[model samples]
Target: MRKINYKDITNQQLIDVRTQHDYQAGHLKNSLNLNPGNFKTYATYYLDLNQPVIFIVGSEEEGHLEELSESANELGFNQKNGYLLIDEVPKEDLQTTETILAEDFLNKSDDFILLDVRHPDEITRPAPEKNLVNIPFEDLVNDYQSLDTSKQIFTLCGSGNRSTAAASFLESKGLNPKVIEGGMKAIQEIGK
Candidate 1:
């Protein structure tokens, strides 16, 4: 993998390696916002190993592109199309979205569709029943179309990280799903 200009790029998946706040502020349209910390374990679930991919890296991750691409290769995704410096992307090409707090979500969850974005193996605790859907964050890329567009969707994962990724992807698809702040851990702490 090597550094490449965004203008010369085409037809490759864009993976954004920015913090959730920076990502929600602005990102390449249709790109998936994945946390770099969980890139190997969680990223694989959302990616197709056969497809060529390019990462749009944040300032903090800029120095680690080679390492990231190496990780991608070791994970069996060898078709890396290189990476882009987030600073180089045109402002017009970026988009933004919103997030919701866990506390706020609890108050009005019944009125919204609750999307449990955690992988099945991660579910060790009970979640609220009303309107809850357990579509793992990885599957949402393909299954988002099946969701009802009329109701608001609240995204949840173990912590707030993966849910933000899910919420950002949903936002790109034109739905306004709020990432439940701090995810299940926050809910559990609040319950306790």
Candidate 2:
């Protein structure tokens, strides 16, 4: 487990090991939210083992970093480039990404590209809108080039977890992506 200052971790992939609500409020730019419980599964499926990754936890107390690092190691992510305590980073340095509510997104469906990043099994049931493009989260980094960069992308997932991660990845690639807040779950509730 390596430790580094936030200033030193430049231009590397950052994974935020914090709660979804905390992550949604603010996080380091280009950082992907990977809840501790889901870190191993998501990392194994979507992340590149060879890419250097920096983990940022909400705090240092109570073994948060230890637990997160243990999970990462279990998934074969042996090389942890660095770990940072979130409190050490300045609030101004943290950035929040744009999000569109499910209701608003459904109402103005034609205004943007609805990119569903959920797995095929999750998307088997069709979306209320017909203009959705399915590119599972795991396939996004490699398949993003196939999308039309001119259009604004609104990413969706089962909930907002995967979508937030997908949006961050897209933003890192210089593409603008707005995550749909609450994702398909919110859309379903609105429909109900």
Candidate 3:
């Protein structure tokens, strides 16, 4: 197994092994779909070795970076370079929707913007009571200007996958956005 460093993966190409329900709920930018259950066939026929690949899943429930790293090695991907991560993990206390809702989101509709980071297909359908702005996870970086970076923002998706990535990117740019932990599912339950 070839050893690679995590810092080298600046292109952000990811391989998802979680369920389809998890993927459609939200995913990383430029990610290629691969179910871990069928990874051998998928990797044998579909994986592109030239591009740097990071293995990901919905959450640690899917196994942390250790599991992903091991799988990537078995699939003949660069073990040294591959990353293992839950699509949504809390970063500093502000990375989860639950944390935001408990302290900030419930009280600050006037001061913050609610951004939905799911695909257009999900956002255009019936949604929860929370006022939300639609910007798919994959498009967030490209269409970032469409969002007002100066304000405090709250981002969510169907399952919190895309929202986490969206929140992190926005934060890296100096915008303090809160991630809705479970994404739309949590929002819907809260509204009900």
Candidate 4:
């Protein structure tokens, strides 16, 4: 894989390899957030193999750049252009999404909608019966349009990670999404 620069890839697809939190704080315009953990599943659904895709990785995530690139190739996207160290992109130019903690979220009654992004098998218990939408993260690519776009949505998963990614996607869809920071972990703790 080749190391590339941001200026060169403006016309190409940019996949941000940082965590959802880092991505929400700042990220390149039109770049997709596909952290390596969800790279396989997420990319499989959203990526267009024909269009060249470049990865943008932070120092902490640089180690997985090659792994993601390889996975992209294996998934039939051989045109993976290269990668960009996130440091090269100006922080002021990055975009962001919002996030809220479980504790704070629970206090709100009907102000927001809850989108549980966890897999069905991982759901050992039921989500809150009200104001909740259960759509697994992988299914979001297909089911996103089914979501209620009138209200702010809080994306929840096992940890804050996937929700952040989910929220990023929702944000891209012209919907308002806030990640449930700490995800189900925070909700579980609050329940105890």
Candidate 5:
């Protein structure tokens, strides 16, 4: 497999195979954080097999890079596109997306499009607002064009993982989407 230097990656989709806590601490802008446990499944759901994907692993754990590379190969990701060692990239080159907390989102519900990225069956509970648009993350790659690009989209999932992926996908498509930090679980807690 090829190894990529951080500065050379211009248009390739970046997938960070790191623990969620590490990812949330800091990650490349628009990079999708695929937790090791869900890497295979998330790759299947969000990745376009034809597009080039660059995997980013923490410099402290170079050992995990090979394992992540193997997992990507098994999931049909072309290994020739290569991996990136996160520490090699300058701190200024990395950035995090904006995330709205559940309570904060609820307060501004009228100003944003509430996008529920959960599966249809998983949405047994009704949304707090009537502006909810149900488009599961699995269908986003194909159905994103149907959404109104004019409005700001706030994405939510069962917890928060799927929404992060959804927001990254939306951003790639040039749509502004903010991930709801705590997702439905936070909303439920607020209701209680």
Candidate 6:
């Protein structure tokens, strides 16, 4: 399988396959909004089969980006089209990250910014505690800009997948962000 990273998507066009709520909240710079399931139609209409196209979404579990690419390839979209850029957190660290966030940061909300990487709708529907910001994984690139580089930034999401990836991204940017051991769900249950 070919490997691609978010950093490799500088010049290519981006297709954000997230909800309208997630799209409006924030997304990668210059990403065209579209739902992942409906992307095939859009690909045929607007996206030239000759040019590259990068696809993004809020979460892999929510929308199978990998499967989307496979479908695209099967449909001959990749014959001369652009590559798809998908960001996913490794499964190995998911459990460890969840434990840390719940054990360390949630109770200490005052001491850190609880950066929730889940979609805005997921966090906002139940409404996170006052200090949380729903940046989502797809929007992490944009939301990270306004943050204070010097302060401690904690990353968390639904299961811990997105948050780990997000934490790595911030670390690369020199923010030195901390990943919440588990994620929001873990924090809610274990935290007071």
Span of 10 residues, lowest total lDDT, candidate 4: 5-14
Reference-based TM-score of each model: 0.84, 0.85, 0.52, 0.92, 0.83, 0.48
The count of residue-pair clashes in candidate 3 stands at 6
For this target, which candidate reaches the highest lDDT against the unseen true structure?
Answer: 4
Total backbone collisions for each predicted model: 0, 0, 6, 0, 0, 11
TM-score winner between candidates 5 and 6: 5
lDDT of each: 0.81, 0.78, 0.56, 0.81, 0.77, 0.56
Report how far residue 22 has shifted in candidate 3, in Å. Answer: 16
Write model 3 residue lDDT over 6-115, tens digit each, in one string. Answer: 34446645666665445434554445445664455445443455555666655533454565556666767652445545433333311222235523455564745678
Write model 2 residue lDDT over 1-192, tens digit each, in one string: 677787798776688877666776788887878777667767776567777778888763326677767776766775656787788899999877788888888888355678988888867546656567999887887898999888899988888888888887787788878888988889898988
Lowest summed lDDT across 10 adjacent residues in model 2 is found at 59-68
Candidate 5 Cα deviation (angstroms), residue 136:
0.9
4 against 6, candidate with superior lDDT? 4
User: Which lDDT tens digits does candidate 5 get at residues 1-192?
Assistant: 578998799888788876544665568887887766667776877777777888888865567676777887787875366788888889887766568888888788355678998888878666666578988877887898988888888888878887777876776677767878788899888889
Model 5 bad stretches (over 4 Å): 1-3, 19-26, 50-52, 59-63
Best by TM-score: 4
The digit string of per-residue lDDT tens for model 6 on 1-192 reads 233465565665566565533443344644555565546644454345555666665554234666667756765665433333333523331221122536656456455566777776776324256456767666666668877665667777775555655664564465656666546666667645
Model 6 residue 125 CA deviation (Å) reads 7.3
